[model samples]
Target chain A: MYSSLILLPFLSVIALNLPFRNLMKKLAFVVCLLVLLVQISLIVCPSICIWSNDLDIFGSFLQFNFAVDNLSRVMLFCIGIVLLAALFVQRYIIDDEERIFNFVNVLLLILIGMDGIVMVRDIFSLYIFLEITAVGSFILIGFNKDVDAFEAAFKYIILSVVATVLMLSSIALLLIVSGSTSFSSISDALKTSPDSLLISSAVAIFLCACFIKAGLIPFHGWLADTYSAAPAAVSVLLAGIVTKTVGAYTLIRIVNSVFGFESSINSLLLVIGIISIVIGALAALGQRDFKRMLAYSSISQVGYIILGLGCGTTLGLAGAVFHLFNHSIFKTLLFVNSAAVELETGTTDMNGLSGLSKKMPFTAMTSVVASLSAAGIPPLSGFWSKLIIIMALWMSGFYVYAVIAILASVLTLAYFLSLQRMVFFGRLKEDSANIKEAGLGLMFPALILALIIVAVGLFFPFIINTFILPAGNILGG
Target chain B: MRLFWSYGLFISILCIIGFYCILVTYNLIRALVGLEILIKAATLLIIVAGYITGHEALAQSLVITLIVIEAVVITVAVGIVLGIRSHNNSLDARKIRNLKG
Candidate 1:
């Protein structure tokens, strides 16, 4: 039954491309929506038992090993919500029937890749899925055929291939030490010889690759360009979940299951996480482009997630995962709002726009919710996760790091407030008087995401016990 | 152990060459070739690991899949290069600086 999660999307892509071109083009959106909706529903109600039974109908033919835990379920839910939002944004922005069809096809392929990434138990299979997601995103980023989009795609491909080479080299080294690529065997092998130079080098190299993929500080040159230059819908998808799944999620999963959070590794995560938080926020403060600023904020938020993970406590891990979910929702909402602003006024430069609240009230209102949530304001979802991480850090005796984390939260709020004042508030520009609200397609997703952010923040106690704590259980297992 | 060191040295040389090519080249096609060289080195490293570990069959299959994926990635990359060429009328990395902050 779990195999069906991967298999169903794979089959849909195949079926959508079958002859009957006109008909498939018409049916593509609905088909993709159905697949995503079913996935979201299954994860929402795990008591259904159909998903839990492990009845693999394709077991005899395909020997792929897949298992899901609380961590994977959280990631799956994020992927579904973000992708659905991207789909709706695409529909409203692109009027060409053929382009929409192609977008849906690649979107489904990415869905399949991300699902496989979260579920696969083997390192090599993990690599395969990561590449699949990378390739699909490359196509999507360059889908608009504009020069800037092409340049962005080219830079991404070059860097991505470099990361892939580094990752594969590390895998090869691990293969030599463990003689197997499966996570269980590798973990066992490392336990027997944790101090070997070979094991340590392999671990370092693999972590470097993940850092590059995740767009952490010092290797983030391509990230802002890629996110801001890609088509609007693709920006929402990439910024929302692609980087998180491939980079941050992989780092967390691998460290927990395979690397065992050694002291050296924990320190490395701590240093890099702090650097990303400080640098990403400072960089975001100076950006004029709306999407680029949001892109930088993404790096900072992911830094928080990594900081929590580095604390190496169950509470910290749970906080990291919870923050990951919250970041996806609020970031998607912010990007959706950016798309709405860009569509209505025909620009994303904050310097060119002012007083959008009068015309595009929904976009402005939703953005305020997202910005406040991102800044760790009280009673919002972001505040709880940051509190947990800081508390965990203090308990773990990283008092300086905890203080820095609090200071960075102030920095986050500073930049977002500036962004609001620049783009959404103040006197209406004389040239922008005719602008109006964005269409329902964009507004609907923005409202849904805003509702999630508020609901999650208001119901923190319930979510913490039922949804987030279970994620920490995977660490011991 | 001796065999591993010899192959490691060779792979390191290939990687250095690949990095140099990517860093020094101005042409987009040359940069892609650099990437291909890097990938080839990684492939060689995997095969050597498999040989040392006596997992010849496993390594062979992994290499095959890696090659197929590499081909697909390079093809899409070349398509993007073509798109870039059409827009700028040149492939120099220096000319594509319109996206900087």
Candidate 2:
């Protein structure tokens, strides 16, 4: 089951770019549709293996291994939704068919990496997927050929390469310890960790590598610049799903499932989480660009997930996973909305213009809704998740962390409101009047995201049960 | 015995030199060279660790695989760096400020 759900995306991605370049959009849509169908099948059938062979050559033949659990199924579903929506709306951003083909192909490669990362059961294979995603984005970031795009792409490359090297070395150490690259076998080897000193140092180095990729407080230098400089679609994808899958998701998987999420590690993660929140929020609050602010916001929000993991309570784990899902939805929506506004208005700078609400009402309103969801207002997706996390914090006997969490929420609201006011509400600048709404290509992603935001807000219990609970149960309870 | 000790100490010192190169240099090309040094040291350390621990499979496979991946990564990275330099005439990261606030 996991094999089909995961492998099909990659195969279809390559397949979509073959001789039938004219039908690229239809091909991508079909691929997403198929993947979604398979993902849904997991609910009932739950495990399908397309390539299963008990007969091994002992060590001669190259092997392909994959399986999809509830965790991967959830991530695959999110990837499908975003990919389909992006495909649906992509045409609006381009008039050149040639450009569309290139863009769609790149998007599929990214989707392939995301699917591969989640389903991969081998650490070496996971590293390959991680590098593919990072390098793929590094190339995509400079797609615009603009000055900032080139610079952002360069910085992101250097930082990601360093992190990847660190990760590889740690994996090397892990291989020496375990003698196997597969996660199942590595888990068994980890059980034989006979020395405390080695375990402590190895775990620390591994966590450092993960933290760099995850952009926890001190290692977040590349995030904001990269987000602002990348194209709108790419920005939405990065903000929505990229960091969560490669960085946070991997960290959670390794520490909680692989390394056993011990108390010392748990406490260590809590410190990182708290610092990420305070520092990310303070940095975000000073941002003048809307997308850069959201990038910083992603750093702070990632802190919440870490905090939830650190608490090691069932509720905390559930809240964390739930927030992971919720953040992907609204944050992607926020980026898509920003993309729409930038497309119509010709600028993303807060100081550039105003009176957007009068001209681009839909874009303005969607931005407002997405921002509200991001800030954790009542009756939205963000609210329920934030409420659960703060409650989890209190339940864990960390009142100080809980208070800081609330303060961060308010701080979040403060910057977003500043963004909201400066971008949408004021009188129209002289040249701002002719700005138009984004066409279907760009607006479609935002529209779906907007509806889903309100839908998740209104029907909280259903989401909590279907998506969050199963994954939460797996994480802890 | 001197050969063994000298080779080990030499590689370790080279590793430290590489890291310093990364820290003090703002040129992207130089930093890339620094990272190459760091990875080389790491590979050496891994081999030594494996030998000390008597994990032969890990020692051999790791040293081989790290060398291959690092080579490919460096190739692609240098190509991109050259592309950047062609456009801007500078490989110094400090001079590149188009992406900042």
Candidate 3:
């Protein structure tokens, strides 16, 4: 039955392309909602697949061998929420029938890839699923087929191909050494102390590929460009959870289960995390475009997640997981807010927007909530997660990283406040007289997300106990 | 064993040249050629690794899957390059510079 989690989305991709355009849109939305419901059910019941020989491809079992652990549960929940929001917000932004159809189709295909990536146990299968996600994303990023979109997509594909090539080489090396591609087999091989430089090189190569995927400092060239150039809904999906899932989650999982938390790897994560935090936030401060700022903000925020995981403690892992969830919610909310602004104003330049609060109260108010949370203000979801990560870093004796984390949060606040002031709080622009509030379709999801941020903040203790702690336990205590 | 190591060394050179082509070349098609070279090196490494481990079947399967994925990726990439060329009238990477900070 867990196979249905992947099967439904795969089916939806076909259903999305059906001839009746209007029906396809509604069907696509409904199907995504149903997908959310299925995911929620999985979270509640929590089934696991030890092994399944159903497909028997290459005379090897590859069907539904899902490891529905706590980590997968958290990710599955976030994916459902993010996809639902993306599909919902998409209606307001896109009008072309063919574009809408293609958008919905690719989104569903992405869902299939994501579900497989989180659920699969074998490392080889994980790479396949990651590629699936990457392929779908490449198409979606260029879905508009505009010159700018295609250019961004080309850069994305080039970087992704390089990363995948390195990953394949690493996998080849690991396969030769371990004689198997399963995580268990590989971990067992590592336990025997293969004191060889080749092994470390393979691991380093794999992590480098993952870092590239995650958009760390040295490997982040493709990130801001792709995020800003994609359509707003696609941007929301990409920034909100795609990068986290495809890059960070996979990295954390491999580190936890396969690599077993070597201090060297931990230091690498810390250093990269610190660099991304400083670089991303500083870059964000200089962006004129509204969405572009958010893209850089995403890179910075992702730095915190990695930093927390790098601490290599249970609390640190919990903080990372919690922050990952919090980041997805507020980031998607902010992007949705951006889309609403863009919808009414027809531009995302900060200078072009002024006193938008008067015209679009829902978007303006939600943007405040999302950005405030993102800036790590007290009594919001982002604060608790950031605090946990900082506490984890400090407790682990990484005082320097802890300081960097705090400084970056202050910088986060400064930029987000500037963003809020520039775009929403100033005098209403003279050219903005005819602008109106965004439609309910767009406003509803942002409002829902804002509410979630508040609710998660208010109930932080319960959420940590129920979700984040279990996820951290899976990593280590 | 020596033969496999030599093959690995050769693949490494191919990969380094491919990467250099990708990072240094101005032409989009040359970049694509670089990508192809990188992929070939990876495929060869996988086969060699599989041969050394006596799991040639697994390696063969991985190579097959990699080839299929590579084909799709290259096709899409070529299509994207065509789109870029048609839109910008140049296949030089420098030509498609509309997006920046």
Candidate 4:
């Protein structure tokens, strides 16, 4: 039944690209939207009998080793939400029918890729899906065909390939010791030969690859350029879920299931998480471009997720997953708002624009909601996740790390305030008075995301019990 | 064990050459060639791992899938390079630095 998540998108992309070009072009967006909506509905209500019945038709032809736990469920939900937002934003921004069709095609491919990433049980299968997602993103980034987009795409290609080589080498080494590429087999092998240098090196290499993929501090040079230079909708997709799915989520899943959270690994995650939080925030404080600053802030927020994961407790794991969900929501909201601003104002430079809220009320209000949530204000989703992570850190006796997390939250707030003041709240620049509100295409996703942030925050206990705590259960497995 | 050591040494050297090629080259195409070299080394490593572990069939299947994926990636990379060439009229990596800070 779960295999349908991967197969439905795969089949849709194939069916949508059939020889009936004119008809397919007209129907592509609706079909893709239906696929995504079905995905969301299926995950939200897994007891749906029709999906299971439909799964059997495809199941006979394709044998996939997919296992979906609560963690995967949360990630699947995020992927669906973010992709839906990206699809809508793409439709709103790109006017050419042919280009929009191409965009939809690649978008479905990425959907298949990320869905595969979240559910695959075999390590090699994970690599294949990671490549699929990476390749899709590379094309999307360079889709605009501008020089900067090309340069950013090339840099991403080089760095991403490097990460890939490292990961493949690690997988090969693991295969030598474990004789199998399944997660269970490799993990069993590691448990038996816990102290071997071979296993340790393989684990370390894999971790480094994941960090690069995730765009941590040291390997993050390509991230901001890719995010800020790509097409607006592509930025929303990349920043919102691409890096999180391929990098951070992979890191979390592999560490928990395959590597088995040793003290050394925990400390390494802690140290790296702190550096990314501090450096990403400090760097964001000085950025002049609106998108670049948000990109850096994304790094910082992802750091908090890593911090929570590094705590090595069930509470910490739950907090980490919750934060991942929150970061996806709020970050997508922020990027969507940035896209709206860039579309309307003709520039994302903070210095060039002022007082957009006067013209674009919906974008402005939703951005404020997103910014406040991202900065971890009370009664927003970001606050609850941050609170849980800090409490978990404190309870685990990592008081210093907890304190740093708090201080970094303040830093987050400072930069966001600056962003708000520069773009939304200042005196209206004379040249910007002609700017109008973005269309319903952009405003709709922003409003939906903002509502999610607030609702998740206000209904914290219900979310924690139903969604978050179940996420923690994966740690035991 | 000796077979493993010998293959490992060769693989490391290949990786070094690949990394050096990527880092030292000014031409974007050359950097891509370097990436290819790196992947070839990984592929070789996988083949050798399978040989040593007696899982030759599994390794063969994985490598086949890997090769297909690799071809797709390189094709995309080359297309991107062509796009870059079209814009700047050059493939020099140094010239492609418009996106700073």
Candidate 5:
């Protein structure tokens, strides 16, 4: 069953590239749906499969174990849903048959990569999976074949190469000290090592590389460009889950499980988290384009997840994980809405759009809900996660960070509200007056996401009791 | 024994220079060459570190993986750059700025 999780997508990539052009899109959707069904079954049974032993992928005796812990469960669940939503959105965005077909093939390849990343135990396997996901995204980002798309792809690939090289160097250093590439051996090596300098240096370099990978404040130059430049479906994948899995998840796992989240590391996370939160929100406030603003918003929201992790408490980690799920749902919903608006009005310039609420009520209402959720308004899913994060900070005696987090939440509200006003609320623009509601292909998946936002919000206690607590327990160790 | 550490540090400095080249250069090909340099440095470091710790087998396998990954990345990257060149008629990073805030 675990092998199928990777193998199914691998198979779909081949199926997607077959000569049957007419069947490509349908086949892609069906494959993604099957994958989602597999994930759901995992959630339902929860013990039908337990992957804990080492295996080799290419007969090299390199260890490739898949651990189905609580953390991986949450990530696998989220990635499954997000992949379906991405396919739903992708079908409508790309006009050319060839591009759409290739997009599906590459997307499934990426899904396999993400699933492998979340499931794999060894650091080397994680690095391989990360590269697979990166390579797929670079191609998908440039799928439009326009100057802007290629430029963004080039920037993303360049920065990613730098980050990966740094990661490789750190891994090599760790291998030298540990004599093994598996997480268990590395942790044991750290425990037995006589010298702190080598371990600390390796950890430090690894952290820096992760920051670049996650597009944290100092290394976020490529994020907004790449997010805004990619096709909307690709944007949904990139903004919603790619960075989370590739960067944030890896950082959380390595720091918590391997390095044990020391106070100094916690402090570094706190400082960087706060910096990204402030800078991302402030930079977002200055954006004129819809998708670009959403890109910055994604950066700011990811900061919240990082901040929660930085607090170094079970509650904090719970909030981070919960917010990670919530962000994926509502952010993907909002980006789909942005895609809808762009499709209808032929542009995403906020200043040039208005009164879309009048013409496209479904979209306008969904946007309002998503934006409010983002701003941490009460009764929305975002509010509960942000509240938990802030409470965690305060309880942990991070008073300053708690205050800044609160202020940033308010700033989040300011920008998203202005976004609502600019894009949906004012008098209808002359050109937008004739715009119709988005077709069901777009609306259905978004509606599903919005429903999830509400469901997660309304059933907050149940969710926390079952999902967040167990995941947090795993991370807290 | 001491020479190994010095060689590692020297390679590290060369890696830094490559990073600087990536940061300062506007040409995509130059940046890519810089990336290649960084990869080469990392490959050497891995071998040297592995030798020092007697985990040369593990390091050799990782370096092999690294080499394959580097090849894939460079191929995809150059593919994109060539596409950019065809579309925009320039390889300078400054010339490709169609999507900015």
Candidate 6:
């Protein structure tokens, strides 16, 4: 069953590359639906088909390394649902028909890679899976073949290359010192090996690369442009999980499970986290483009997650995980809303839109909801998560950072509320008067995400207590 | 003693040259060549590190692996640079300031 989760996407990719492009799109959707259902069922009962303990790929002694644990369950579930919805939405929104076919193919390949990353326990396998994800994204970004898209994709490729080189070099250094790249073995080696300059230095460099990939403060220059230039759904992917699961999620795991977070690294994390949150929010304040704002917002939100992780308490980790989930849900909605406006209004500039609520009610309502959530306004999912992260920071005795976080949330509210007034509160522009609500195809997914955003807020504990708490425990343990 | 000192000098100068070329280049393609230089320098450093510890034979394969990975990276970098130059009409990063924060 676990293998199927990884393989199904590959099959869909093959289907996508077939001559029948329209049929391939529909078929890919169906396969992903099946995969999602299978995953949910596996969560219900994880004992159906066990992955073998031994199977090697590329000459390494590969193990099954697959388990439907609580952490992966949430990610797989979210990724599955989001991919399905995004696929449906893309069928119509994507401009170039030929590119759409190519994209769906790469989409499935990226999904397979993500599934592999989530399931594989070996560090080397994780690296391989991450490389596939990176390459897949590079193709997706460059899909449009226009100047802006190409420029953005080029920057993304360069950054990813630098980051990859740093990461791979560190991996080599690690293997030289540790003799194994399996997480299980590395965990044991970490426990036994005397903390020496070689291992520590290698680990530090690897962590830096992860930070760059995650787009935290110092390394976030490439994120906004790349995201703003990509098509809507592709931007959604970048904002949602590519950074979360591959970068932040792994950071949590390695810090808690392997490196022991209370040492020097934890302090560095706190400093970086605070820097990212403040800088990201301030940067967003100056953005004119709608998607560009969300990009900065992503960086800011990710900063909160890092700050929560930096707090070095179980509550903080729990808050971080919850915020991570919540951000993915709302950010996708926000980006999709912007996409809709751009699709109809033909521009993503805030100045180009006016009193849009009267024109595209569904889009307007959903955008307001997402904006509210992001601002951490009460009764929205973002509020509770922010509240928890702030509380965690305060509890951990980082009063200054806690204050900065509060101010950042206020800053978020200020920019977002102004955005609301500018885009939805004034007179409807003649240019946007003919704009209409997105079809059931696009609105449905946005609605689902909006519903999740609100529902998670109302029933915040149910999610946290059940899924996130355990995941946090695993990370914190 | 003189022979040992000469060998260390040779390797260090090679590594330094590689680092210099990478840092001084302005064009993206030239920067990539610099990256190759650095990769060579790094491999040399790795081998020397191994030699200092008397683990040279055991570390050759890993060094070889490093060189191979660098080759792949350099090729990809060059290809992507080509595409970027076509898109932007220039490889100079100074004019590519459209993506600032």
Where is model 2 chain A poorest over a 10-residue stretch in terms of lDDT? A53-62
Give the poorly placed runs of model 6, Cα more than 4 Å off: A15-29, A32-64, A95-97, A475-477, B1-24, B35-79, B88-90
Model 1 Cα lDDT, one tens digit per residue, A1-477: 667778888889999898898999998899989999988998898678666655465644556678888999999999999999999999999978899899999999999899999998899999999999999999999999989999999999999999999999999999999999999999999999658888899999999999999999978989999999999999999999999999999999999999888889999999999999999999999999999999999999999999999999998899899999999999999999999999999999999999999998899999999999999997999999999999989999999999999999999999999999999999999988679999999999999999999999999999999889889766443
* 2 versus 4: better TM-score goes to: 4
Question: When superposed on Cα atoms, how far off is each prediction in RMSD?
Answer: 1.2, 3.8, 3.0, 1.0, 2.7, 4.1
> Which of 2 and 6 is ahead in lDDT?
2
True contacts kept of each: 0.85, 0.28, 0.72, 0.91, 0.78, 0.13
lDDT of 4: 0.93
Error of 2 at B62 (Å): 5.1
lDDT of 4 by residue, B15-101 (tens): 999999999999999999999999999999999999999999999999999999999999999999999999888988888778988
The lDDT of each candidate is 0.93, 0.75, 0.87, 0.93, 0.86, 0.74
Complex DockQ, candidate 6: 0.28
Q: Which residue pairs come into collision in candidate 6? A: none
| Model 6 C-alpha lDDT per residue in residues A1-477, reported as the tens digit of each score | 466677656666666677976776556555655665665565656665543333224214334465445567677766776666666667768656565566667777778777887777766567667777877777777666655766676667666666765666565555656566667677777778788876788778778888888888898878898899887778877787777777787677666655666657878898889889888998888888888888888888999988898888888888887888888888888877877888887888888888888878898899899999999998888998899889988987889999989998998897788877877789987655478877777888889899988898888778778777887776422
Say which prediction, candidate 3 or candidate 5, comes out ahead on lDDT: 3
Among these predictions, the greatest DockQ belongs to 4
Candidate 6, residues B34-57, lDDT tens digits: the string is 556655655654565555545567
Please give the C-alpha DockQ score of model 4.
0.93
lDDT of 2 by residue, A20-112 (tens): 767775455556556555554554454445334332332123244565666666677677666555555455665566666566667767766
lDDT of 4 at B65: 94
Between which residue pairs do clashes occur in model 3? none
Point out the higher-scoring one by DockQ: 4 or 5.
Answer: 4
A205 Cα displacement, candidate 3 (Å): 0.5
Candidate 5, A347-388: lDDT as tens digits: 888888888899999999898889999999878899899999
TM-score of 6: 0.87
Error of 4 at A250 (Å): 0.3
